[model samples]
Target: MTGARFWDMVCTALYLALYAALYAREIPVPAKRRSVTMSDVAAHAGVSIKTVSNVINNWPYVTEETRQKVVAAIEAVGYRPNHTARSLVTGKTKAVGVLVPDVSNPFFGTAIRACEEALVEDGYSLFLCNTNEDAERERYYLEQLLSRGVDGLILWGARLSCDELEGIVGADTALITVELGEEPRRSNHTCINVDNKGGACMATEHLLREGHRRIGHLAGPLDRITSRQRKQGYEQALVTAGLEPLPEMTVAGHPSVQGGFRAAERLMRTQKPDAIFCYNDLMALGALLAARYLGLRIPHDLALVGFDDIDVSSIVEPPLTTVRIPQAKLGRLTGKVVLERLRGSEGSERVILCPVELRVRGSSGNSFGEEQKKATLDALISSFSDGGERPA
Candidate 1:
């Protein structure tokens, strides 16, 4: 063989050996680093870029054959569309912001879970924020969420004023209030709320019917609408029952366990109330603990009732007989309203007043040692005229 020919053959052999060694070593070559793009998928699928876009957006214009081809190509090439780029082009984030006072509270937790489920069904994401019942924090979170370009906002606290809320409501962005009253200025925003006054009245009347005339109320901060409405209801019930609403029978504090404990301690020291109605179950639990510290027997020495029949209420030593609010339903309704607004539904902001029921357990009883469980149960059942069972 010729020397040049031999040299060429040797070079070829060496090149082949190097290739085999590399292959055996399994050393991955640096790829071109091409980003997954719509054009790439469209080219692979033998379709137009618009057709690929249509399939990705679930647009109805694309034919089944074309959509199937595009989907197959996308899967084969691992072509995932950039959601951020799509959102930028469409100017729609497809996200909703939910702001609540306290995420730890069972009522808020249940509401958030329901809202998440409803939004999930509609192919939307949720950004949850907890304000911890701080008005300043609520406003800051609202501004931050809005600035993040969420399509809609669901507010569950009474921190925003009418003027402040007006700045947030507009055509592009929708607003919904959960467990709060309607904004007087912007009647266009939707709201889902409970009849706070009515529920408080029902609870107070239950104690009254059980022959507890000198009932005291553990009130929340008067600045909040729920607290004000509940206080009104408690007073109204007393007036209706021919009992004078005395100032000394009410104690105001934060809607917290510590607040409840302090209020109950003060009430007990000044004038021991035969029965006590707390603003919420947390407060009621605190009052119960305070009563125990005082060596008082529940229902026999001091009857108690609370609101927001949270999960812990049923697990306490003596199960709490409180007012039950449909927390999950409230959340689902809030999500639905926000979605409707997003769809460009126009009308007066809907004000949904969900009903509340009294849950009678072993907490409230009569002086004769007879548990008012049957009467409370009957009342709760009768309150639900639609025949739906109360939340267990």
Candidate 2:
């Protein structure tokens, strides 16, 4: 063979060798796995598939020995029940739906957790939906949840009227609505009521007892029932003290920090009240910032009070004095009510009311002296500088 022919053959051999090495280095793709089935478990347990089905569904007639055998076999075979198939046979999805105006809100978050805690014990899962306080969104969520065959629904601060709700909800799905205003004329569902009026009164009364005469109110959106009820309570407190509830002293805004800031600033700039009672904790936080911006001292120049003793309420600059809603208890109660409705234990639809308490803190002027306030503020500042740990 010529030198050129020998060189070409050598190069081809080298190329083939390199390609084989690369292919060997590559990881092989895994094949699709077959799921473990009830048949496999039944075969392993030496029992009929019908017996396995009876054990899974808790049919109450399976012998304990057979049940243990099937369970052990299921564990060994790694069998997972088909939820869709089981739901079809039982006609129950074993799920609950929860609709809230704002899921990000701390109050709702606490309530949701509490409700879920109560529900999960009974083998029920939760489907959470955020409506964002929109009527159309609320309707869409209701439709979707019902379509998924949720066993029950818990609605918090929904805007849908009773007629609208009745028209949409079927008889099979149990509903428990939170803070939906007055008792419904129709009685197809249960209502959970919180004492917004009484809670507001408590906040206002606390400020009054602290000797704040020219007290003002930073109200939430007037359209919301909670906001209106809170404002009414504030007015009632003022009237009970033989003081007129002036329109200028009561300002309405969105139930948000920005809304509170704008409304509080406007109210302070024009009316110049000594103290302010806020609609909720979020608005109260805004009012605090507004007070700082307007060169007002908290509790010294402009005392403040808020509703909804959220977690942050206790950790703010001087801490906030606000009305506490007992959200965990309320949530657990809500879950219980939903369960009762699901079981058809109640003869008629009814309303349940939850109570509230007032937590006094530094911002209310009666608690936490100047030195302790300074120490708390210092600790909070240090916590951020030292790895963002919360102060105990």
Candidate 3:
């Protein structure tokens, strides 16, 4: 698409997003002095009401100049669509249900914002709901939204059981789940998740290439699928580097800052490691704080890296070398998939894997550029030869 068309779509989506969010928050709409209608817009633009309808519906035959005129009149009068009437005619509520585990997490926050924008552009509003990581809460919201006549659902949490989730898919509700570790075994539901294992492997390998033979991992609970995959990837990277996988090197946590802090402190006192890779940014932050409390200088004494390049990752002391997940793109893709199912144009999008990359920073004490890698490898050889300290 051309740049102009891209921006037009974005602006349109954002305008609808603002209104949808306000409605969900229970804010009262401002009453207009005079009710604005298609007729009013038509009169203002000096076109017939049918012409105005064509512009609103994006009819291909309408001239570009005519569409611009109607759009301008729409802004001037601040007219909103009569979605109730439209739904009555089309059998679609023109609204979508959204479930998120934690909006406070920057990863979820960015994805939710993007999903809302993309859905709104296609004339679908969102019923925003936060589940707070409770499987029962997620199921309750799922039922509630479905009962309320939402056209589709975009969910970010997977605490619900396979049977419970299959019930929704059985109804053909046009659902898409984000960050699910495993794909749902249903024809109606689609799953989109980042390459968690691949990204974790990248983070661990980066540290290994930096000459840190003794690297530790601050991991999430093994019960969770995502955490298990990440830990597996970390171990795989060690084996690939020809290092024996040490069972004591993995310290499990809750994927939170406090979890990371306690885990790091415990590891420091028992198993000494030259560097640490956390499952996420929040955990890495906790580890960073723990390192300070132990009076160990970062990079010089303990190198650090984290997953999920959250907003704070770049602003933290010495910044963080981490994995960057394209959260917004994930959201946009989910939005598109849900829409397609609702429209009957597609089925079973299956699994969509988004790409991730490493962001080199001062926390690693060594960037992974070509020259730096060569120098670091040389240093690694020297450190092993005579047991000398490795150069950063």
Highest TM-score model number: 2
Model 3 scores a C-alpha lDDT of 0.81
Task: Count clashing residue pairs in model 1.
Answer: 0
List per-prediction Cα lDDT, in the order shown: 0.83, 0.85, 0.81
Q: Candidate 1: deviation at residue 214, Å?
A: 1.6
Tens digits of per-residue lDDT for model 3, 1-392: 99999999999999899988877577776887887899999999999999998887668999999999999999998878787776777678988988887667777777777788889898788888988777888888888888878888887757776567878646567878877777677767888877888999999999988899999999887766678788888999999999987989889987778889999998887898999989889899999999999999887899999987776776667777888876667777888888888878754458888888987877898443456544535654674554222322
Measured with C-alpha atoms, the lDDT of residue 364 in candidate 3 is 91
Where does candidate 3 stray beyond 4 Å?
1-79, 242-244, 366-392
> Candidate 1, residues 211-266: lDDT per residue as tens digits?
89889999998878888889999999999999999999999987888889999989
**Model 2 lDDT tens row, 1-392:** 99999999999999999988988577889998999988999999999999999888777899999999999998999998887788898888889999999888888887788899889987789999999888999999999988988889899987888668867886667888898886754455888888999989888888899999999999987777888999999999999999999999999987778888999999999999999999999888999999999999998999888998776877887798888887767888889888887777767448888888787788879567777666655764775564333243
Report clashes for each candidate as comma-separated counts: 0, 0, 0
Residue pairs clashing, model 2: none
State which candidate has the highest lDDT: 2
TM-scores of the candidates are: 0.82, 0.83, 0.75
